[model samples]
Target: LVIDEIKGRDLRETLIAFGEHLMGAYMSPALIGVYRTVVAEANRYPTLGRTFYENGPARATGRLAEVLEAAEARGEIDADDCFRAASHFVGMIRDNLHLQVVLGLRPPPDADEARIAVLSAVDVFLNGVASHR
Candidate 1:
């Protein structure tokens, strides 16, 4: 059995670090690779299947919130639109990504079928967020 271990990191510290990177002050290719690897792994593993979707832990909440907040602050989108975009993003993550993790499907490469299934979810999320303007 492959057991996933959690490290004991302070949530606030982690959030701050994420904010720093996401705020565009510093971009981390490593972080992007990590997330890509996650998707790839989820595309693997048969048991993992399509359960990766709806996996709340896998959803990057810090990035999501920061993006919404930044957009609002810039007046790029109204509050209602910002919230709508966030909701759309969250919903897609829940229904597609989290759902895949729940199905026991490890990331892609191991489960290509699962990855294919969720692409539409990603598209929808992007479209929704962009529409928030």
Candidate 2:
């Protein structure tokens, strides 16, 4: 009976979990969509779109910096906070780039992390725009 119980418990190791399927479904389009959204939104900003087109990653970082600067000038948030926010946003993007390749693990270890990162980036963008406006 005891051996049977252990085998039953160990059965989980033999079976593939369901979340692997979900992340596989979501991650690809997500990476592409996020890239497009970031580019599209940055373009909406004055001179930012061209800057991004000429130099992608450098421009993305620059856009975040510009947003941070505007936020600082408005006194709505601290500079370090903006920097941290942008760092997370960048990390999330970087992680998403990696996670798409490892979708077999249940729940995809970085899926939640990536979602939060994307949200953080969007939040910073919105807050920055409001500050500048």
lDDT top scorer: 2
Question: What is the per-residue lDDT of model 2 for residues 1-133, given as tens digits with 9 covering 90 to 100?
Answer: 1222233222222111112222343355564455556556874684666654556445444555555556567665566666565555444444554445444333433656655545554555345446563
TM-scores of the models, in the order given? 0.33, 0.34
Off by over 4 Å in 1: 1-59, 81-84, 105-119, 126-133
Summarize candidate 1's per-residue lDDT along 1-133 as a digit string, tens digits. 0011111223323323333322221113343344445667875763343453344322445345555666567664455665455555545434544434434463322234434434545555434446565
Note the Cα lDDT for every prediction shown: 0.42, 0.46
Clashing pairs in 2: none
Q: C-alpha displacement of 85 in model 1, angstroms?
A: 4.0
The 10-residue segment with the lowest total lDDT in model 1: 1-10
Each prediction's Cα RMSD? 13.2, 18.2
